[model samples]
Each structure stands twice: as structure tokens, then as C-alpha cells.
Target: MLKSSGMWWYEQFARYRYRQGMTYARKGQYHLAISRFNRALLHHPQPDEVCIARGLIYLRLGDLEAALADLDRAIALNPCNSKAYGNRGLVKAQLGDEAAALEDWRVALTHRPCYAEARYNRGLVFAHQKNYQYALDEFDLAIKANPNLAEAYLHRGNVRDELGDRFGAAKDWQLALLNDLSLDAAKKALFRTRRESHEQRLTEKLGAVLAPLDLSLQVERQGRQLNLLIQREPGTPVNYQDVAKLLQAKIVDLNLNWLERFRIIGRMGTGGMPDWDKVYQIYDNCACPPIYLSRILASLLFFMPFGIAAIVYATQVKANYAQGNYRAALTASKLIKWFYWVSLGVFSATASLVVFGVVLLLLRGESLSSIIESIRTMPSPRPYLGRPYADPHPDPSPQPSLPESTDSSAD
Candidate 1:
């Protein structure tokens, strides 16, 4: 057999294996890629490409330490390798070393200014830190480099919103929606900005009757402030009672964690075995229970009467307003305010009553001890029977029988 050229032999063996490893990595056959990369590494001991390929394979498999080792060796072997730094930065980011990751990305950018991946990753790091301006700038550059990048526009829109540029943010979000309709952030923006041609009835009514121009222009008639934004939608009718019911439903999601914990504790409390106490102790030691249920109870106690008063007042106010009885509605609103104060007073008094009763019980256990003593010291009662124990003298022989009084009239 003819002797093969050294370069050709290396190409046939080492290069072929490295290319095969890359193919395997692309197919997500991480283990096979690792094996192929190792074989290639043995043949081409100092090859930066082989080292980088192995690093990428390790990174894909979540083997951060192995990825870092390969990346470090690759960087050492070729100090000017911007791709190695970029790959290493991604691994560092996955490990939560933002500082190290940013540094690597920065180095990658300095070496290869057009590295879009590094720039985008660095921008995300900035966004994670809430440094939105810098994040926005980086995203701007990323978009310039790759104009079709929908994610850059989305994040830039978020950053703009964070910086109080609602119009700009809306524009960006709209563009993002056009690019990718799946994004909920963009959809929310579109919803909020959407408006119809129908005139607000409250605005028209308030405008016609009220005075001082601006004061009369509000969607709601709440004194002189003229704040219209607080009013609910005009025509798409919603039952306030049903809204309150739905609000209670939505509130359940907020307390689910504590509810689950309480359920567990409640179940334990019902068990016959004393082991529940140990479980409770362990849970208490590990995590303090949320006071949300207590807060909910306290808040209900705090606001229930006022809530009922408002509900009662609302029907009267709406009915009066509808009947063109503005004065009655105004009076009803004042009464509502008065009821709020009264409810506050009642809640305070009720709480005081509870505290006072608790203190009384703590001091003297229902006053039973004193009551028992008073009863013990009192004279005993004689039993009633057929036979009497004592009798008083007959009432002095009945004072001589009274003369026939009826004869006085005849005399």
C-alpha cells in the first residue's frame, strides 16, 4: 500500500472525527458527541477547534465544570479565540456567575465587535440587573446587527416602559406583536391602547350639569377633582355584585401556598397519633406559616360593616342618580361616608369588648370563685310543706266585726 501524506492522514482521521462530533452535537446526541470529541482530542492534542467542540458538547449536556475545563484549555491554547470566550460566557451565565459571564462577553466583544450572541447575552445580563438603559442600548445594537430579532424589540419595549416611555414602549410592543403574535406582553399593550368611538355617558352627563369647566368634564362627578380615569367602562355592562364575587375567586390564587400549608396542618391536627405535633414543630422550625388567613379574618372584621354599608348605599345612589335625583344621590354618598365612620367606631368597640372579656377571664376565671363564696355564706332556706313550722297569733280577733256599712246610707 502507498504511504499516505501526513496532512491527508490527519485530515482522514482527526478532522473526520471532529466533524462527526459536530454532527452528533447538532443531532443532540451529547454522549456520542463527547466520545467522538475525546477521540479527536487524542489525535489532535493541541487543536483549539477540537477543544471548543468538546466544550460545547459538555455545555449542551449541563456539565458546566467539564465545559469550563475544556473552554479554559481552548482559550489558553488560542488566546485570541473570541468564539471560545463567547461559549464560556454562556456557561458562566448558566452557573449564575453574572459578573464572570459579563466579563467574558465583554472580552468576546472587544476581540470580535460584531459578535451578536455575546452582545445579546450581555444585554440580558443588564436587564436581569434592572439596568434598563444599558440593556436597551445593547438591544438596539443587536437589532441593528440582526433586524429580524423580535426578542430584542420585546425587551427594548419593556425597558422603555420601565423608563416611563409608554408611547415608545407601545410602538415597540406593537412591532413585536406583528413579528411574533404569541407574545402576551405585546397583546396586553395592544389591549390597553385599543379604544372605540362611543362617547362616555358619564363624561357627557357630568359635562352638561357641572361647572368650572375642567371640574365638570370628569367621567365621574367626585367633588372638584374631575378625575375621569377612575370610572369603569360605560356600556359593556357588568354586575358589580358579580364582579365582587369574581374578585373573591381571584383572591384564592394569592393565598394558595398558605392554604396548602394550613390544610396539611389541619389534617395533621385531626390525626389520632401524636406524631402530628412533631411534624408541626418541624414545619414551624423550617418555615414560619403565613399570617394571611389571620390577616384576612382581621381585615374582614375591619371592613365588613363598611362593605355592607357601601353595598346598601350603592343601590340607593345608582337608583337616585338614574331617576335624575342628583341631590338624593349626593345625600346617599354622605350617608355612606357617615356609615364608614360608624363602622370604624363599632369595630374598635367590638375589639375592645373582646379584649376586655379576655382580660376579665384571665384575672378571675368567670368570677365563679366569688359567686360560690357568696352562695356559701348566705342563710339556708326552709322547705315548704303541708305542716308549718311557726304561725303568727291570729290578728287580734279581727277588730270587732265591722257594722253593716250599707245601713249608713239609709241613716
Candidate 2:
């Protein structure tokens, strides 16, 4: 009776410590939680639960080896613990032991037939191995067991896609989206698939409509917008607004949502003249600074003999004028006109200097040559008395002998 009472007391204390550990764990105080778990284990009551809890904490902390050890001990303490097997499978998966992980998951399912998580994990393993049929089966079972499992649907969709059932895959993805509205990946997949389908149908429908026109047209879907590109033939007349209205009518007939806008681009023939209105619009809405074209033209002038600054400035002026910024256009035109006159004046001055310098060189060539010859023929001075210096070039003339000193007595 005394021993039973002692065991009961130890069990109660162990349970209290385990509760404290769980509280710490909930608060993300992992070290404190682990300490309490260790104390709970030391009391030796309900060791399986304590081991499983510590193992999960270790797993959360990314200590795979510790997690494996604790989970193994938990399984040994209670072999029927499905949760221990499931968690061990996760650790094995993290360790890259896929085969072992799959086996663990299977064992877990055997212990608890309704284990949806284990079934889902097994499906993931099959998917990794490229066994699409098996993966699909497992995912289906998992879904049946837990209809609200969004990940199962998401992964099943992928497997279905791999099996070449695009419609089935799309259905699964839609189901996943409906199950979990916050799943961004599912949303993206559904959007992409639906967009591709819409683009294909639109292309076929637009192709039929453009057949009689004998013009090459392309239909592109960009998000909520539909872009129509019409290749313009030389000497062929096309009204862009009319074409836009026609395409919009066709799109409406197809029962698609009214596109946010229609982008009609007319493709000019090779080396053909560009539409001035289009060019103006392009420059008017450009994010570049107003002087961007000016700088580019100035850079080009270094390589080319002609300056293009005036032309670029004129283009900007025309663009601004067409956009109803008449004041800005006038100011730009005046600035460019002044710049052109200044440039012409500078060019004239530079050309005059170059011409004058050339003429001077031509006229003074003989005089300069004669002066250089005189300088070459001039004689060098003799070295000073009593100071010997080395001569770079010896003179060809003989040196005169010094007069012999007559007064030996004076010496």
C-alpha cells in the first residue's frame, strides 16, 4: 500500500511537470520547456508522452538526432503510439531517409487506420519517387479520411497534372482553393491554368474573325487585358479605333469578362515609316527625363560629323505640343533654336582658326627650315680658362699650341 501511494505521488508530480513543460512550449520558451520535460522524465511516470513531447520540441528546434532518440524511446515505451511513428517518419524525411520515412508512415497507418497525416505524408513520399499513380491513391484516401485537408488536394492536383489529366488537376486545384482561401500557391496555379485556356480559346476565335481580312493578327492575353497586334501592309489603310471596336465585340461574343482594356498595336513593315502619332504618344508618356533625348544626341555627335540635338529637340517639342502642353513645346523649340545658332557660330569660329593655322604653316615652312639650318651651323663657345669640360662632339679643327714660357727663372 505504501509503495502504491509512492508511485501515485510520483505520477502526479510527473504529470504536473509535464503540464508545466507544455505551458513553456506554448510560450516558445523551448529551453525551459525542455528542462521541465527532463524533470518529468526523471520521475518515471507516463514516460511515453514525455518522450514524445520532448521529441517534438527537439524536432521544432531542428535537432534531428535528439528528436530521433527521443522518438525511438517513446516508441519502445509504447509500441502502439501512432503519433511517435508519425513524428519519427518526419525526422527520417528530414534526414533524407525517404525509404525509412515511408516505412514509418506505413507503420503508423497500420497502428491507426484513420491517420490522415500519415497517409498524406506517404503520398508525399510517393510523389517524390515519381510514382504518380500511388501518390494519387494515397492522397485520395487522405482526402476521404479528412475532407478539409487542403494540402492533400493541392498535392493531388500536381500528381494528376503529371498523369496528363489537366482537367482533373484543375478541378483538384479549385477544390484546394475553395478549402483554403489563403493558399497563395493554389490560387496562382488556378490562375495560370485558366489564363492559358482563355488565351487558347481567344486566339482561335480571333483567328477566325481575322481570316477574311487577309491581315496577320495576333491575340495576346496579359492579366485582365487583351492585346491585339495587327501587322500593317504597305499602302494598306487601317482605322485603329474601328479594329479595336471589332475585337472588343468579338471578345464579348465569346462570353469572357469585358477586358479591362484593349491594346491595339500596329506593326510597321520592315524599315517602314513610323506613325508620328504613335511616336509622339510614346515620348509623351516616357518615364525618361525631358532632356534624355538631348543627351543621347550629344553623345552621338562625337562619332558623327553632324549634330542631331536639333532634331531630337524638335521631336520632343512636337510630342509635347500634340499632348496639349503648348507652352512647354514652345519653350523647348525656342531653346533648341538658340542652341542651333550657338552651335553654328562655334563651328564657324573653329573652322576659321583651323584654316588660318594651316595657311600660316604652309607660308612659313621655308623660313622656318632656313632658321633651323642657321642654328645647326652656329659655332659653340670655348670652355673657360682653367675649367676643363668634356666635349660631347670633338671639333675637326686643330688646336693652336700655347706659347712656351720664356722665363724659367720666374717659374
Best by lDDT: 2
Clashing pairs in 1: none
Q: Which lDDT tens digits does candidate 1 get at residues 1-411?
A: 655587557756977788888899889898898888888876673588788889988887779999999999999999889999999999999999999999998998889997877778888999989998899889888878777677777888878878878778878888887788898977876555432111244345433432322222223222222222212222333333332233223323223222212111111122343211111111221222122233333434677866565556656876776676544565566666666566667789999997886677757766756655765899888777678666676666656676665645663
Worst 10 residues of 2 by lDDT: 276-285
**Reference-based TM-score, model 1:** 0.45
Error of 1 at 310 (Å): 47
lDDT of each: 0.65, 0.78
Error of 1 at 253 (Å): 36
TM-score of each: 0.45, 0.56
Over 4 Å off in model 1, which ranges? 1-4, 44-46, 174-411
- Per-residue lDDT of model 2, residues 143-206, tens digit only: 9999999999999998998898879989999999889999888888888778778776777788
> What value of lDDT does candidate 1 attain over all alpha carbons?
0.65
lDDT of 1 at 304: 84
